[model samples]
Target: MTIFHKLVSRFLISPEKKNEIGFCTDLDDILRDDGKVTLKIDGNKITLDLSNLHERRYAACLSTSLRYPQYDIDNLLMAKFVRKGDRILDGGANIGLTALHFLHFGASFVECVEALPWLAERIREIDDIRISVTEAALSKRSDGFVDIAISKTHNQGSTYDSSVIAKFSHIFGDDIKFLTTPTITIDSLTSGPFDIWKLDVEGAEIDVVNGALQSLKDCPPRVIFTEFWDERVHKFASVVSASHPVAYRAGITKDNYQLELLDMKTFEKNSEVFFPISPTYVFLREDCKEI
Candidate 1:
């Protein structure tokens, strides 16, 4: 741990937690193929779960996700607009890494809601029938129940709302771990229509975009990869000024980890060039273009 302390903690970390997480797995093919770390996606495989650590970015974010697998470039630009059969809607499906990158970029379907019913049975132990995980959690009210506030040494997130996970004061309130669950509204957890909407849900992404405002006005997701925190940036500018269209605020390009979108007025007049703890946005709606 000392190539000069990993180049001074890689110049004091940033580049969106190093390559904007969500695409990694290789570090000598997962510690020389032993304590589990395999990954193939779309073509299957999966594995992972290197027996948890007290939490050091979950073991340096899975060995910096296999030693900087192109630093995840915002989930590789949301897996280049996932097309194959597309139907993603993985709002906070943590242990499922954006539903295994929209089922390895062919989507075909993916529900993975997740409120930690044991990480939705550990994402159905990765069996994948186009995934369905779903432990329940959506917002803008749906019936009731919604406590959440997990953090177990931070980075693994979850928030129902306590003013949106109370700015993570190291996982606030008795260092988080409450739970409760049961909240529906994304059109009552969908009965139809879906075409990409991988919201990370750290700060409730504005109560799941205010309970999916009538399912984004009757199914309107061509893209909506959520998250742009500055204490939720006014709940992502009040759900992108009421239901969508705020493309590009994406980040992670401190020097080569590609992707740097930014346009909403130069990303709200430069918030120190993003990477301020949750900067992933790719909204696109107004007569869309590029997923």
Candidate 2:
């Protein structure tokens, strides 16, 4: 091949489709040798470590778009429920992106709960007074710790769920590492009056609810955005029924970014129809269901 053709083939385009990602020319400006990227979003700077193999996809997006990728449903939920001066608990925060989004959407304060120590430290390094980081896995217990399964490829896919671990083991085969992380109950974290909560603790949403029964009763949040699965749907809803009477499966419309709310009753009857899709849900207080 000629010199120009060789340069185009090697740097501009690749024959292998898998290698096409994370190959922007300006990548060196943001991505460092250690795989850290200092991304500027809407004038706020967030430095993230995207060294993990699975994290490169995010790095590629951050470098190109200058936005932290988030689920449209989450953006919709936050836009609708997160009122000004709202206090939010961002449980299972991965590098505090969603928490930053919460702040951007006008929340006065966001308490981020993360399982991995390193990830929590990254959030703290942001130095934003509106955001605080707590390093602990949410569980039914206030003391002791839990063993979480961390995947070598997908750091954000860490979980303490047995079913998830089994499935990941079968699929990835020895790429998962077990780490014992500190545990804390949702009730023990604060004294209440939080306006909103975003919980994405894999399949442990029920345990978090169980651990926060007291807080849920005394100082119930107006809205809760969480993840739920087919097997634990009913139990998960039942646990928080007293505080949050109405539940809806949240998602963006197939055509556009419109918000779609499916009633829990309807979702429960036909969950298989939405399987492998977004399992995120919104539980609302009776008075707040109109939103």
Candidate 3:
């Protein structure tokens, strides 16, 4: 965030309220020499270790500690669909926050795929069991490499996907450069049936799902949490068709606080209401009458 953004977040919003609403605090103010912070979530005081974390990752520790109930759509999806022994494929698992949450929810195993090496390192540092972190993007090419434009001061990261690169340029300036990262397909990553596939790959959401077709065919996930926008709407809609099942769009309120679930009809009609990185969705294969 910029200096102006930090100031506004500091004076206009109380630290307690900001934590409650999932608003990020200034990086320096939150971390001490020991690289840990004591935070209150749902009135429970907790101290999270961020010792080996990157500056950009402190937000993950904060959100994970609080579970961002009001802002993180994944938190809501897990509450509704995930259960003990369930296996979760957390594609684009930034900092592994949601992956940790899955384990906390009793998931027998959770595999997290992250493109950035440092973020992947943080995931492993956060836990040692019931979770595996891979520092590679899930793509069509098993041996391919993804070029990513990374934001050094913020959590923004993007791949060479047309829409993503465009937005990356717009946000980080035209001269921004990309670092090549290893890539692997989902089919090559997992061996057995998984219960849910959670993706937050910015604009590469469709590509990751497409590459996972073989895996989806062999052992379809009961639930899929996708982040979509106009650029990838067709691919998303194609996978979500008639008779698939009932669906709910999960998003935050205008202020980025308060989770909202919108039915398919409401979602399509209000497409313009969403902005990138602001919402994620949850879809299920179980029949409406069943779930």
Clashes of each: 1, 0, 0
Q: Pick the candidate with the highest lDDT.
A: 2
In candidate 1, which residue pairs get closer than 3 Å at backbone N, Cα or C atoms, i.e. clash? 19-71
The lDDT, on a scale of 0 to 1, for candidate 3 is 0.64
lDDT tens digits, residue span 1-291, model 3? 534234334443455666443333334355343445544333333344545334223444344333233335566568767888899888888766577667767688888988888778867776556778888888876888878877543444566577766755665566776779988888788544678888778787767767877776666777888766554655575664432355677765554454567886686687655533454667667553254
What is the Å distance of residue 124 in model 2 from its true position? 0.9
Clash list (residue pairs), candidate 2: none
- Please provide, for model 2 over 1-291, each residue's C-alpha lDDT reduced to its tens digit, 9 standing for 90 to 100: 333223323443345754443233333343333545566655667875556533443544544422221444577688888899999999998877788788878999998999998889878977788888889998998888888987666557689898776755653357566899989998898624589988889878888989889889888999989876555867888898998989888655433336667886675575544423457888899989896
TM-score-best of 2 and 3:
2
RMSD of 2: 6.7
Winner on lDDT between 1 and 2 is: 2
In model 3, the runs with Cα more than 4 Å from the true position are 1-70, 168-170, 240-245, 252-260, 268-277, 288-291
- Model 1 regions more than 4 Å off: 1-48, 51-113, 120-135, 139-141, 144-181, 185-198, 201-239, 243-245, 249-255, 262-291
Of candidate 3, the 10-residue stretch with the lowest lDDT total is 62-71
lDDT of each: 0.63, 0.73, 0.64
Q: Return the TM-score for candidate 1, rounded to 2 decimals.
A: 0.31
Q: Residues 1-291, candidate 1: write the lDDT tens digits.
A: 624225324534467675543322322233322254545555665555544431222333433433342336546776667778878888778677557766666777788887778777867888877788767777778778877777665336667666556666565656566778887767777544687777777766776777677778877787777765564565565566545555576766544555667766686687564444356668767766543
